[model samples]
Target: MNKKWRWTIGISSVVIVLVVLTIIKIGTTQGAKPDWYSAWASAASSLIALIALVAAAVAANATIQTNKTQTRQLAKLEETQQSDRASKFAVWRALHPTRDSQIYRTFFHNAGPLPMYDVIIHYFVNGHEYTSKEETLPPTSTPELVKKSDNNLEWFIKKLAIEEYGLYQPKTKEEVAAIADLKKRAEAENVRIELVRAINEGKNRYVKDIRIETGVSFSDGENTWYRAPNGRLERTS
Candidate 1:
């Protein structure tokens, strides 16, 4: 089964055959009976020994070659495992964007109407993820204080857009639901609205998310703005 035993067995068989033939040769050629038959037998024994030695050498070489192939295969398997782990990590980071560490800044309103804009914060959301798109903020105050009595809700929404109009980013049908959800959350919390919406308002493709501007809209058609982690103001894309 093992190389050592296989070599021993092959070598012993060859030596035993040669020894037997040599002993017979010496006996037959002792005296008055010089048998020529013993010489041919001795030659045959030598040929058998040479064949067995070649077989042992071939078996050893095959074993070494097999080990080499297995080692190479094992190394490749480890490399593939490492690569798979790294790819999964990249995908997760892309999705969440906000993992660990302080990587972003934002602003929002706390509560109440015109005379108070309580808290204007600049803090990090999630450092792990980057924006898939931009989000807009809620209006600063509700229509409860407005003078319009007809269709109070719509009036209030329009007023909020005009007065604190800084928070609105035009919405596609799909984004409308998310905006509504944000409004509901803002009412329930009774605090400043926090919105990070994606936009394509400019030539900058990298500006995917914009924080609310609190109370400012651009001149013609641009109103969205990006707040970097250090509070640098940027025109939205």
Candidate 2:
């Protein structure tokens, strides 16, 4: 069926035709066979044997090549399966209802066929970095919401406001009245409330203007992996 087989069959047919013609010539001879007949028969027999050997070698080589190709394909398939199993963890995001909806939450999910361990997430909010507590995630489990109280954007902004402008939220009616009077005095003097001014000038902008970057690192008991904010997953170990 293949090229090598086709060539082998064609050569064998040609040799048979040559033998048939030699016999016919001998039969039609007017006397004893010609002197070259024995030598010609011997040479033709050797040629047939050589062709058979070459055909056998070609068939063996083709079988070896086919087996090598199949081996490579099976190895690649196994590598792909292992990669799928190890790269099943992901980081998730959602808004949280707190501090007037000025904060968000980070979550982790394990969608793989195995459990992930020592999971940690790194967050960068407007260039300020924060890290989450380590945890373990089970395969095909529900997404785990991060609950660190100090890890929210609202807390970061409040901390900055207090450090830079001595700003604090009023907790009582008297404090509220005091802040209101202070605002009125600033307005009368055509001056700005430092905290309010900073917020309005976009120095401490809202969530829409905030840039948040996130990445996650986890282990599959043998190797570690990191998933970047842009969804690029790579092995770390």
Candidate 3:
């Protein structure tokens, strides 16, 4: 029972005891009835009515509070259920042939319980951005089911070297001499091999000076969400 109900019951018991004592005193009196006796009886009746009203109000308030608590719990449960499956959609990266392979590829995988719609991926490599979209991506439990992108790490780095660093294939003797001079400067500066290979092919040149980041936005038919590169997921709509 509620604390207010307990207080109400205690007050009602005390008032009943006082009213019983007053009635007993009236019954025991001998000659002229005391004027205060009628006043005490009327006051007792009024006190009982007031206690009843207070008890009723307390009961109603408790009911309202209980309902509010239940409503909040139900809303929380519904939200958890809706996001459970969508949260499992993720972007994964792996190197082809082996983990130490120079060629790295990005893939879209839905380990979620449900299929995602309007799946869009954004890739950022050293500030250069690329976007790709798909109509739907289905959930999968195996690696073979994951979808790969054509724009891999090797492609992105090569593009960056050509566009940002102004590295290109030499067709003339002058252009070739310029590349040789650039390579000498690069070697003196201890530049990373991946950048060097972007200008001219070399062995064991891996992706360096390239920072890759990915983000994804998709839907579960009812709601939309976005997942950042750091794996933080949030609802967009």
Q: Which number leads on lDDT?
A: 3
Ranking by lDDT: 3, 2, 1
Question: What lDDT would candidate 3 get against the real structure?
Answer: 0.69
| Candidate 2 residue-wise lDDT, 4-93, digit = tens | 776877687677767756765774573765767767666767776776677677778779888999999999897666568666678767
lDDT of each: 0.39, 0.67, 0.69
User: Positional deviation of 34 in candidate 3, in angstroms?
Assistant: 3.3
lDDT of 3 by residue, 38-112 (tens): 777677678777767767777778798899999999998898888887887887565656566555567766787
Q: Pick the candidate with the highest TM-score.
A: 3
lDDT (tens digit, per residue) of candidate 1 on 1-237: 466866786777768776776777676767754566566566666867676776777777768878888999998887554333221110010121246743222223313212221212221222221222112222343222111211232223343333333444443344454555777644533322222232222212222342322122111122233334443444343
| lDDT of model 1, residue 90 | 8
Off by over 4 Å in 1: 1-36, 91-237
RMSD of 3: 7.9
In model 2, the Cα lDDT at residue 237 comes to: 79
TM-score of candidate 2 to 2 decimals: 0.55
Residue 1 CA displacement from its true place in model 2, Å: 15
